[model samples]
Target: MLRYGILFLSILFASSFDVSAAAISAIQSDLAVLRLCNASSPVSLQAVNSVLINRDMKSSETQTQDFKCFLLCLYVEYGWMDREGGFSLHHIKLTLESSKLPEYRIKKLIYSCTATEITDPCERAFNFTECFWSHSDKETSPEAEIPEKEVSDNQNGFYYIN
Candidate 1:
């Protein structure tokens, strides 16, 4: 079910944080709410898995877009982000708390990746992910930042991996 999938995702996220077992269990319980929401329609489980598994490595623009879209799909499905791509601070706080991440890190993420300006949910999500990863502390985070110098976009709005 969706609950299990979300739990799996929580585990994947928590694994990056080196969290306690209690925190992991709490995240699992918290992610149960995702089951009541819609599933990710635009992204498949395979796509999600691929992104999560290879997030730390170099990836093509298409792969990056897919990963960002997957994250956006989850946000929309969870109702944390509106269809128009507006971010809810309350929902973000709830999710971060559920994940048991440090308050400072959560605040930093919220500050850096607020998607209020973006009108399209998908585009907003993609931009948010890019910002999140770019601003992340590589030593403390599981996913490394994509080098800005190496990232270039084409006319089609897709980034090119150099």
Candidate 2:
């Protein structure tokens, strides 16, 4: 029984680590996706491509600088500012509060770009119809949705043994 308890605890801890790793990976991938979208701009393309080609080059300083540059790029794209380099004037603030972002680079990104809310950048590319950012407030129904009425009609509806 004691060995079983120890094994269970180890499994639980391992699973938690996996979950945390997954969250970090998701955030990193989202950043990468945003970079790819802005690849048309010469400067943006270079910076983004550098990161893409050399994942091992991701150091604390590089991440900080890259994130800052990304925020600046967003500002430029949104017409919040005419030029780059000077990021202090932008309205949105993106702070590196989490441990995942060790070298904190806080700047206004959400509000300045007229982004009322933050979005997962990784998901933007999948939407073929329109710019995901434009319809931030719009709600999308699930594609494989089941009505609540149908669910309520069956006793064992929730179970799918097959």
Candidate 3:
């Protein structure tokens, strides 16, 4: 479309802020995907608007089934969520890496919040967005130490050498 072409060409020029170019590209990409997903999902324009404006929609009463499905469509399009409701962590990490945040913080966020007991794709999408967003607001100190735990031979998908 002409809009995307214009947006794409605009990204070639530098912006005023340090991460403005990346931020702009990310935002533009999101908008394009959102519009495409919006067409296929049973969500309303109002629902999209509300969700975009309010980060607390997961807990809000406005989080309808349509809204959840819309979110799922977004994740699927972004390659963050697959057909089996599994998250492609590599894609997620790459997506987050686009942000201005440090690598450690992004990894920490993914590690702490990605695991869930939810089986439904729509529900999982909602949960993931809420989980990721909630923790993103709380700043974790880089100097903070994580308590070490002993690893078993077959724990968390890895075995100890010894």
Query: lDDT tens string, model 3, 9-46?
Result: 44653354466657777777876887677666656555
Model 3 backbone overlap count:
0
Which pairs of residues clash in candidate 3, taking residues 3 or more apart in a chain or in different chains? none
Regions more than 4 Å wrong, model 3? 1-32, 58-61, 143-162
lDDT of predicted model 2: 0.33
Off by more than 4 A, model 2: 1-17, 20-37, 42-84, 89-94, 100-162
Q: Which candidate number has the best lDDT?
A: 3
1-162: candidate 1 lDDT, tens digit per residue:
444566677768987888988987767654543343224434444544444555432344325545555566667656556555666656777787888776667766776677335665677876776666665554344353422223333433333233
lDDT of each: 0.57, 0.33, 0.67
In candidate 1, stretches whose alpha carbon ends up further than 4 angstroms from where it belongs are 1-46, 56-70, 136-162
Please report the candidate that would top TM-score against the real structure: 3
Query: What TM-score would every model get versus the actual structure?
Result: 0.50, 0.22, 0.66
Q: What lDDT, from 0 to 1, does candidate 3 have?
A: 0.67
Higher-ranked by lDDT: 2 or 3:
3
Tens digits of per-residue lDDT, candidate 2, 48-162, equal 3444444322344334433444544554443332232222222222222332322212212221222212232311111111222333334443342322211111231121111
- What's the residue-level lDDT of 139 in candidate 3? 88
